[model samples]
Target chain A: MSGSDRTASLSYDRTGDVRMSSSRVVSLIARREILTRLKDKGFIASSIFIIVLIMGSVVFQVLIQSGASNVTVGLTGAPQGLSAAIQEQADIFGLDAEVIEYDDESAARAAVQGEEIDAAVIDGNSVLVSESLDDTLGAAINGAVNGLALARRLVDEGVDPTILQPVSLDVTALQPAADDAEEVGEKALVAFVSILLLYTLLIFFGQFIAQGVVEEKASRVIEVLLAAVRPWQLLAGKIIGLGVLALAQLVLICAAGLGGAIAFDILTVPGAAIATVVQVLGWFLLGFTLVAALFAVCGALVSRQEDLQSVLLPMTLILVAALVLAITAGQNPDGSLARVTSFVPVLSTMVMPIRVATGSVAWWEIALSVALMVLAIVVVVRIGGRIYAGALLGKGGRVKIKDALAAERVS
Target chain B: MLEFDGLRKSYGANVVLDEVSFTVAPGQMYGFCGSNGAGKTTTMRIAMGLARADAGEVRWQQRPIDLEVRRRIGYMPEERGLYPKMPVAEQLEYFARLHGMNSAAARCSATDLLDGMGLGKRSKDALEKLSLGNQQRVQLAAALVSNPDVLILDEPFSGLDPTGVDALAANLAERRSRGVPVLFSSHQLDLVERLCDAVGILAGGTIVASGTVAQLREREANRQLRVVIPGSDGHWARELGYAHVDSAQDGVVLLQLDDPSRDQDVLSAAMAAGSVAQFGWRQPTLVEMFREAVAA
Candidate 1:
């Protein structure tokens, strides 16, 4: 088929040219709401003021990192000349190691017991010992003590100390997988960022849709506009318009806040996290459209703003439950509950990113979650749009959900 | 021009409009007069495309009124709506934008309309902060801000003082002069009688009496016009074959003219008699006509 012919076949005729609808009404709606919201003192001032707070928090976290735990080593015997080298290793490991002079081995043991030092290192002829049951600590000390003992043996065997030490073994990790420390740090950073973005977006855009609906209903302005636009179209406009607004704010914060950290090397995220960012963004859009649409519908059902929280409280509880499940997913991305909710529309927006960050899930699961979310958004738009249209015109009375449904069914 | 064709709507079992049909022509001021539950509100809502009718359609010209048609139609609902917290200018601009004006144009037109309404500087004031009269004035401005081609206002003059009433009367007349069709519903029968070229009286979801005010007045054959003059009024009445002289006040004798057209002879005779003064026509008011319609 020709390109035009294929498109013609693909696109069905809706009451009017649905194609032309985007720029025609959508632009007007977006421009009106965005301009008014941008002029709002809350949006403008908080956007500026919040970033300063976040930047301050970042600085405080970095400062706290500087005062890491300092430990002391009580060494019983330092096989001649190894003391200085062992001290270098301790400093490299980001710990403070002080060699304490002990008159007897019992005194060194007492020092470790009395908490005067972190550990007591007693040098036997070939073995090394620490007081606690920590074998790794004993091993680490032994490695340092043995290197010094080897140097002493070489000198005693008539080899020059400098010549014997000519060959040096610089310890290196054998496998890249052993670098779980950096990986864990990277995963923790991703988790924090994802959760922050998810919660902020939900709150920001949810309020936008909810409050916009309340405004329209309150002024009874909706009665006039319902004459022109279809119910769904109006609801869709507010959701999409404010969705664009919240997205713009997110991009701004992400650019300045996360962007600065990534660029400065204070934070590092995985390549998968990058891909997950894009996926998470899609889910963000989907989840928000669904949530915001539902809130708009709820807002219309109520006559006043005071009743908003009562309706919203239940929805908030659902979100909290989903977030809890999302955290559970982050810790174990492949667990049954995590895997299932990760692909579920409501929970996936918060869960899927962490899953992608920590676990190797099948690519199809990501696609399925997105597909399900898209479906959820469509359903919300249809159902919520109908309810909004029906409920919007009912003034001075509660908008009965049953009545709205009945009206839709009858029409 | 907006036209409702056999429009029918009901709430539960109560029919608000049953096959109601009417045409509001361009540049003519039409009044909708009805008692409570007389389907006046429902008809106007249907005409404005705000409510759905079970059976017929509301058409602009021949086709059903679409969004484009709706945009060109201004409606002031009965409840006196203005965003209580929104500033006057912002509220007006929002409605204007919904009617297809861009933000800048909407703001400009809204500002100009507010200034013309004598609410210029108060445009920044919240709607609730304004006095009730001024708030109503802003509501009127909201309806007019879009410069709609057809205006449908429900009870647009109910709570207004004389000045407010005059403003509505003059504004509607101005719009009519500019070739806009204006139809409004009101219980103030006197105002409706004075302002409308055509009046439709509805009762029980149907138009009971409709046509020009003159036609409705002419339909009330039982009502008679009384003409009066001073001195020789009794003799003049006898000459004109009048049944009786009703009364006299301020040297003006009341003569019951069975025919409203037989006034010229009385006028000439009164001049011949002495000092003829009270010469005018009084059509029966809509309150009387409404009572007649409701009875039917």
Candidate 2:
């Protein structure tokens, strides 16, 4: 016999009993789950891919927005004073307009037709545009041109243009909405990204927990696992472990995106951006727990991987529906449908975050939504744990969900 | 000691186990044998707490088994289960941890058990990479890794080769000698006869016969005599009015004596017919005892 053989034989003689702690066992199981998943190449590759995608998208959005802000126009037979007036008007309207002096009317018209300039002003009178102008751009250009024409008319009438100019009136409004239009735009972007991240993370990690449960069942390792820990402990440990992994990946992606945006000057306030990330994360935990518990139950309903699709279809459809509702809510944040769904459990995970971003949802509504989600999670975990304990030991083909629910717990 | 007390279970209207009961004393090896769907697996499963019994309980040392006590018992289900993707050593160690062994102890125990099973060299290999028999050995190693106080193995020898059987039997004997009560179900009566101190034969969801090998064989002794007469036709024993002729072949006749005290009458009859070479009472084998129990 080898040394190990001798040791093995001696083990039977050695009768020291080790104490078992339920929490310790749960932690160990959780550690095993985390370690195994972290080592999976598929998980690592997907996480890195999502991070890169988020960062790349932020950079692309910044480039497009910056490009859209600047407008180039051609001028022909225009007064030097008119050029300065256009510059001043453009600055007031927050437009970056560059004037290119053309030698004659044909040059300015050709420039507008060739797309070199957005529009053209020929002889400080008629504006030339190949296509119809946007409202904001037209208003700014028409105002500038009309102001210069008025000044020229005043000079011809033997009155000084400066004396004819009306006294500027500066009226300050007392109250403003919490955020400006630009801030609201930024919030909408943040909310959209957050919702997308939540949807992706919930679906991916929910399936992950389900797959893990099915793997243990298929391999028959669940038998041994249940002997040591209660079914609820196992389920809780799996959800927590996978939830942590999903959160880590989510944080990485969000940080990369927001960091990229900040670096490119697209997002001005880091504090607000971080707050949004935190809020999304908080909702993610609630949504993930509810969905993941249900997933574990779904997984226990089948023993084979091939049968997983049938068992998991309803939950998948629910997730997809939630995502669709959230996206529609994103479109009209203050709509009645968005307001109603924001208080629902699964839909709220997606809707409330967007409402928090785009609309001024009252604090009480946020509280009610979170409370409802917690209630749903509690109910789901209770039912899911029971099903998991009952159906985990069943063998043969897929177990009927009704039968699993009716079956008695072994422990 | 491990006691299964009147475990009754049913799935819907189908009763899988009906008032099944047995006991395995300390240091005793109990062999559980049954026909297909005779509730052998169900009984073991209930004992291991993998399935709930409609009534009855599994007691360890006169106390009902709970999670704390269950952790000290080793169980191998009829359906062999091991994570195919996990390395053999890690899988065993994980099971040890589930059984309440600390990480370092689990590692050591897994290493030792694998080495004892002659799978030390293949410990690093994924379970799927090993041959079927080696995988079975690893499953057995997993059961032994916890150094359990009680063992409930459901068909541990179903798919093993001769060497695998011997190794498992030896390890089980070692555990038994160390005062651990071992209960395992198997169809191999020969191995069971050689290894088990007591045997329980189940039929129709109940134990039909259960006792030591000799005790069961003694219970089955019906005072049948095997008579070998040289140069005599097989019909002579039938002509002597022995109503139950168990078998007759090649001048040898096995007869169940209607009156055991009248054995001399049949013996004299055989002597008058021809020279009697051998005449003696027959001892039943375990296989014969099992068949009789099942048949009854």
Candidate 3:
């Protein structure tokens, strides 16, 4: 080859050739790992298990939507039109409302005396309506009945109907009500999917990175692997490959669930949250990485699969704590713990939901927390990689955490 | 070529290997025979870069061992390991990929090794479910599946049945024929005598003696001669008056007059019997040589 030709061949105009090479190697190693591990009965089975879990959640939501609520009510002497109106509104609101009709005021009053229904609307010489339910629904019935009665009396009194009924107060919520039935359903959906996404991603992928490292160590496969690649490379591969698997599962299951919801006109979540799914995904990646590395470091300290529980407790509790924080964050999101935990890497995975539950978090806070988590992941990868490399070659004895971190070059 | 230069290692104050050194050239099968706790495992591990030495270094091809060199060196620890839950074929192939073999190559090598070892039918079986001897074969196959250049095996024959031992010896010989240098440690002195081109005899955490089989035998300063005849009592030893190791009937005596200066006199005395069927001065087998070295 000529000199110019050699130079031309060497150059692809790929400015980041070294990075490209590194990533390519990482991708290949990770791909190999994923293929081998994914073929594992445990991995495949648990994946199927997760899919079932996700599908079960969908079924659960559907069942809950279709089932009758745990509330009972009775009505008496209500006008036919007003009762029909109340029942129609209740049905549309996904409430289980049962309206019972009574013969006379005394009879309706007697039923109320018997406590048969939660509420009664009685029409008589003086309008008597039972206040068993919310005032809004009760007031609705009252307004409808009282207006009709007043109009009737005006006619009876030979007065102009429009003149007697001069004033009315139209009570409305300070905030806007959703325009369409689908919007309300969509709002309900965002909360559920977000929670599901957070739960599945952390659990599925977190366990993966941990177990993959431990398998290599226990089987002596890591000895062979450590010969050819650095510990970080192996770990990064496991994390990236299995992490991708978990994320893919998430997208597939969530898409199927949401698609079915849309197809059946159940509930719809907003698309605005779709763009910010990256933020949630970002949080997951950071959290998964940190926990995965720490779990692996801990996993290396144990040899048997049975020992995983004790080794996994710290990470498990951290996860449980984070999840608990996240759930509590959903309720009264501005609470002190919720506020502090949301920004902390240890607690961020749990805290994102609370922020979403309440309102949009400050963009700066998202950036800062994500940045902090990413930085933590980098440090973890570095230290965890060292620990893994050092301990992988050792025999069945558990390597202490400190000894693994102190890098004395192996002969 | 793999070389260890002035390697020193110790477990606490108790020295395991003191300034140990050896060179394994291509196509050479260097067997390391040692008494228990002789530091053969430690030296081999340091050469494989698996263990850190207190002093000295391991060099491959006149330089420090690198990743590329490591890729070419197959290692089998005396303490064996395999993924218990992984299928046999997949387990071997997965380790092959770690050595830079593509998936297809790994699969092909794994299948071929399993088939050759009479385990083709059980390729998909879990490792833990296999018989211990079969697991040993699988471990051997994992080492060879990558077709490594320098092989380091610790006690490869220790736990093997007769057939498994034969399989391993055959495998190592084949690798030698293919010009892959091999370093292996074992207490099976007889097998090492038969299979190794050169042997390193480790005792008391150091190489007390190392040479070709003939050289090691020659290094012994005495001869042990066994003579048998059809007639004459154990007192035919009166006919052959020399230091005797053991004596047996009609006329049989293991003359162990270990003074090499008197080798001819002893041989001539045994040959004096006109009815002597066989008499020759013989250096001890490696098993005897090892016993003597350890005794020393």
Candidate 4:
């Protein structure tokens, strides 16, 4: 370490002609965030878990639907064409019914009593059952028997059944037709799933952004990062990077759920389910951006992880409230409360997805909700970016938001 | 050239920097010396654009520094930091890329810098896994990864061992020779004196004195002289009416001369009092100069 040796300096050879563009700086920062989280075992494991849960639910629904749809019935001394008549009636009612013929009434009664068949129609006149007949199977058998007796009477009276015009009441309601029970059940399920995914992903990704912001401050690395780029750029990079990751995960889970349901024939209307998935993804981006900006600001307000919860409480509460409202909206998607809340910014991201899944939201309502969410995102990011820039370098404890706003811009 | 032009900053009613201005020319190393809370870190932060100056701007090559230009300056903050969980080489490469190096160039630069710092073997280890000294070296390497055009380091030499200090000094000297302006603050005044071509002594939120080491010495009044008169008892110089005795030890007396032109008169007076054993002008060291400046 002599003076002469100190004079023998190492040469720093400059290496490239590349100059960093602002977008490139943002992308570089984003790339770092993405890589860091991608390596996180928790993030990876949670994503896989969500997808598996969705696929598992779809499989469970398939098993239940198939078991509930099949029915078996026994027949004894059935008249000519009676078996075909029952089959036709079951087919018209969308039932998967199997009609088994016994050698006599005694055998048919014995089969029903033994529970080998769900019920029995003896001599094409009376229906016997083990305990009580399945309503759908009983209706099919009654329709077949009544239709056969009417045809026989008409022939014996020498009346031409075709000429005596078949009559059925042409029913109409003054109001729009209500969704049948099954359809309503399907819509409710769709709403529940989409809203739950939106709520969960929103909160999960929001905390990630918050933790990320605090990590840099806690480690005191924000100062070095702020030196080369503007604070807004750093914040933007974080939001966009984590936002992309969350979006990818949401898409993966949605695809898994939809694919499983369609493959197992659980979802009869694939088109509607696919549309709900798209809407949820779209709402997710908007909602995530809105919350992420605030989370970043809140995170910058604190220098330690222990202090993060208090700072994050307000935003977390907002998310919880959104989740509750979304659940409520799922139950009453056509109610005015749901209708109006579906247009609110943060609430809309949760509620509107449910409304859309129920097919109760108009195109303009969705468009308005999305537009408002985007607007909210812009405003939040603007103010939040400032606070983030202003507070990121503060040391110790928590930085007051007012002071942070008044502080000098990092750039 | 990098210039901090009349920068002023205050926190509430507490003024941190007051009209602070200094410049580091191309190929010049400017040492920033200040006591604790003397605004050294603030000035450097302002230069790096990590903090904004209330009244002035930092300029390079006669233009004000903006975000784009700031990317060209390598900065090390007072608080030593990098992503602790990130591997050494990856962290360095990330910093290099942030400063505008392309991917391949960043990777190459990171490798070379790590090898130079003797951290080549631990490049794949997380930063926290390295010993404190090695972490300090990696911090330095992060600042130099992009081969920045200007280096603004706060307390860059505070924790380095002698060998580490020498390596960093040599590295900075090379950058200076290559026409990069370096402004680094340190508590080690002797090192600043040895390494910087020019130095700025900051006190009470302002640069009270700044120039080459020799220029600062020349600007200081009252030169000290060490005179030895074997039997004089050390009172002769004070009795001569043109000097003050700063200290007296054994037979040698340290005298502060009121005027430089009277050195010969003091010499003749010492000779008349007794046999002169030694007489020489004692140049004030940077430590001494620093104390005097801060005290003033």
Candidate 5:
């Protein structure tokens, strides 16, 4: 719209214009923050680093898992059917075993000592080894040898050995475990990943927002901004802008991690992983808003960048505590500490996500925790906004929160 | 028209502004003159809605200035500030948008303002890359980018070189011609004397004196006269009984008149003594008026 048309309308409908202009101001500020930060080398580097870290971890795990499952077994003068039997038994045990024939026991022993093969089976009656054998490989070799012996006995008794097929009884529990071992492991992984991502992002974005607020104050840009719009608008714009950036980075990292895990067949349950991502993202919004508001207040409390660390210490400690609680929740998701702290606002941002991921939290618990966090966010934002406005124009090294609140009342 | 009607502000037990009242009518350039800690910045902040006035309001066209009107007012705070990492042109555009201009209009305004300030080539450069003088110009451009209806700048001319000052003066003059009311605070009295149509002298949290320059001068000027008698002793006015000599140097005597109506009589008395070369009522400059106002 033309400047004249806008100005005319501004005066023509005062009440309506106020509502429209505030949002416009906030968006303008938010856009500036986004554009400016996009050019920052630090922002780009951190984002790239996180994505590579996530993908790299997944690839490394896949390699380790593949390498761990492979086994090479050496044989010396073993029966023809024995190699095939060993291969079939190893397959049942989920091991990829390769049996290689040797001219004699000495050669097989020498191969095992050289570490080329994991172990050796010498004659049909005896199983050979270097140092010791793993239980899975031992069981596979034992089962093969016993079956061969039993068949020989049947032949000696003039019975049909081909009809002597092996059988095992089917055992079932009335009520199985809620989560299988693999599912529990998957959930634990989700808990760890979600917590780590949330912790790193919350801290990164919290500092970004705080430093941003201080940058304005130190540069004295707040004066010009406050002239056109209210302090709350500036605060809101900064939080929303940085919050979106933080959320985007979180999503990118989660998606890359999830995609990599699935591609490499690392994650058994993809749905749970996706749900964890959603929960982390949802909690992150509330968490960032809560912490970002306080960070802004802390930033306003100081007039210089050098003083930021001291003022930020308390909030940083709180975040660190949450991080610790989140890790503990991952290990003991149903523990009393995790359960109780999952309802606390700042701590819940971390603990609740882990609890949810690990399947220890009920739907009502999540809802109540979310509601409490939302309430805390509302109160924190309101108070923080006041303190921010009060201390924004204040000059000096440090301002007490009490003084800022008092100043806010006067203003 | 912008009116700051009885704006009062206080910090703790100390009052920074006490019923500080003044107005800049349309097309008028009002100069705010005060010593250090005289509440000039505070008054301007209140008008811009950057600070709250405890007991009064800043009204425009007899209406209290709300967010809409505040966005329309161009304000440059005493503390000069802009995003140092932001490109100069983009920073100005952001400010324009904050003042309620749409993106396209804001862009146009920012580009034009930057070019007008001779910063066209450097518009793409970060603000911090510019010299302090150039940065100051960019700050001014930010204030003017929205083509504001009212202008309130605190210490706008401080630290500017002569060329920069002239550039700013011209910009302000153009705005004044376009029916915009401008209020700027400055320690530079001579520039204020030459530029502002009305002047307000604030001291001890109050406007001690404020009016048109001529009106203030007239009010503060003592009933004194200066007469140059080339061939007579300078004690002629004292001997005439209607006036007494205030000072005398270089054959010209400065007289403190006992009455305003006796000026012609004194002139006749000077003619009776010798040939009169020069005679006029002595008026004080703005600096003198300010010193006296603050001192009082």
Candidate 6:
């Protein structure tokens, strides 16, 4: 037989049994999604921008903390005993103060302007400052200068300076000590960063899923894809693929922030901070799955990219509401509202992580929140998959969500 | 053999396909023709498993075609879709992998298909960068990359130029020579008539007429006769007393004879009037047959 004739007969055998494993097909689709987005210049550039912002925040926090450690006072025409009195007061307040004497008030003013000293004790009793001092530092300087002026006045009035010396009063509080207060501040910062990360990641990646779906539908590629794989597989694969990308970007930004904090010695108790990060990452997976599924469904409802915004409005609103609630809840982690929201399914993904990072949340609450999130994810996936399969191949204008839900499943 | 049997589908109260059925044997090219909304696309979509039919099944070699079976069938949708931002070869390879080919095999197949489509140099170019015709070629290559057992294309010739049409025809011919059953829909009836082994004409969601191209022409010509005589305006056909006269022009008359046995009398009358140049019956073109099928 001729070559063509032989090949014709050979094709009969080729038709028998050529099926791929399900997971393999899903991975192939997932890989395509990842590669396509990774190659996109916009995705890459935005990822880098976020990392820089994270690192920048870390650096800013470090600079503010280090600047708080020292107080320098430039002196002009101060009394002979004033310097010793100021030193005594500084010791009492646990402040490190450096005294520099200049020739005149003008020189002291110049020194303050040049940042040679934080404040200047000009003409003995008047305090010259370039800007407003924080309450604690201002109080320390006022206390020292006032005490010396009182002593000098008593001596001039022919009264004994010892008799006029004020008694030292000590006060104690039931609240946490200074170090504990600093720890509280750090915890709040951690929670704030955690919420910010969750909000941005969820929003960014959620939109990624939506835009990806619209691209497929708008380009008419969904038909070809629907032929090869089940609708659920395509939906799940896209979510998982973009989820992986989002997680990678999140990890990089978080690592950059953590590394910056360590390098600048800004973060104390690094182990605890790292634990908070790990918890945030865990909650991110739940939050991402819940939102990504809805995004896909919304994406399928619109054939044009411009129509996506209207269809996605409800999802965007929900995410924004979650974020606002989470931020308000972060301020009072142990409050009743925060505690209540922590167990709510969609809200928990945003609230529970912040509460866990900042306060001593009960283990049962965290477990319950996670369970609720998982349940929500399951429900969303079922409904979202149906809508996606129903509306994906629909052409011309936008498909109504109600119609899509009512339409029969394609598969 | 690929068989689309008793397919029925409806959107809301409007029926898109009602009892649309056809079969294509291995190594044969079947042409599916229809006007807009005649269920040509719906039927192909059902066969590819992209859409579910309300009632009916697509079977391959006596087994119902499912996801696994669809993976082995190449399908080009009516509205061609590919990732505009994806590189040509990469997208094809991606599709091949989705169809169950190994990564290495997919890569090789993608390159081979692109090279065959005269897109070898543009393999790395994004799909959007290519001209519309080249993009269409890439879409076709994507369908063929898996070396599918059957090929189903909807309007594969729609946006193609003559050269593109020729290239696509050559590729499809090669597949057909390998015993691959190819079913495609097109409005270009001449191309369908020339290339297809069998033709199915759909109207109002039903298969109005279907058979081999020759068979359909012969069936349509059975009742119709075209008579031509030299030096006559073809007015002699009016004297035959046929109930229907299709047309008369250029000294030739096309008639639908109520009694075909009367053809001899008609021929004698024409000969008596003038020397007969062409008196044999004429075969209807695919376009003519499509109109007649849809009209009926």
TM-score of chain A of each: 0.70, 0.80, 0.71, 0.80, 0.80, 0.77
DockQ of 1: 0.26
RMSD of 3: 8.9
Q: How far is A411's C-alpha from truth in model 6 (Å)?
A: 1.9
Query: What is candidate 2's TM-score against the reference?
Result: 0.88
Candidate with better DockQ, 5 vs 6: 5
Provide fnat values for all models in the order shown.
0.22, 0.47, 0.25, 0.55, 0.40, 0.47
On residues A66-106, what C-alpha lDDT tens digit does candidate 6 reach at each position? 67755788888987766777666776776667778899999
Q: List model 4 lDDT by residue over B16-93, tens digit each.
A: 999999888998999999999999988988888777798998899999998788888888899988898889999999
lDDT tens readout by residue for model 5, A178-247: 7776777776786677777788887788888889999999999988888777889989999889978888
Q: Which regions in candidate 2 have their CA more than 4 angstroms from the true location? A: A1-4, A7-9, A13-18, A70-88, A96-176, B239-243
- After aligning candidate 1 to the native by TM-score, how far in Å is the CA of B20 from where it should be? 2.0
Q: Which is better, 1 or 6, measured by DockQ?
A: 6
* TM-score list, all predictions: 0.77, 0.88, 0.78, 0.89, 0.89, 0.86
Model 2 chain B scores worst on lDDT over the 10 consecutive residues at: B215-224
Instruction: Give the docking tier of candidate 4.
Output: acceptable
Off by over 4 Å in 6: A1-19, A72-181, B233-236, B241-245, B248-250
lDDT of 1: 0.71
Put down candidate 1 lDDT per residue, B1-296, tens digits, no spaces.
66878888888888888878877888989999888878888887776666778889888777788776777788888766666777889889877777777667677777777766678889988788999988888888888777777888988998788977886687778678767888899888888888999889888887888778888887874344445554443565556575446665556555557675666766776777666656654456788778978897
Please rank every candidate by DockQ, starting with the best: 2, 4, 5, 6, 1, 3
List, residue by residue over B1-296, the lDDT tens digit for candidate 3.
Answer: 77888888876789888888877888899999887788887887777667788898888888888665776778887668777777899888777776667667667767777777888899999888999888888887888777677898988887788877776677677667767789998877778888998888888766777777778877663566667776756564655555665756667667677465676676566566547787766668888788878778
Residue A263 CA error for candidate 2 (Å)?
Answer: 1.2
RMSD of 5: 4.8
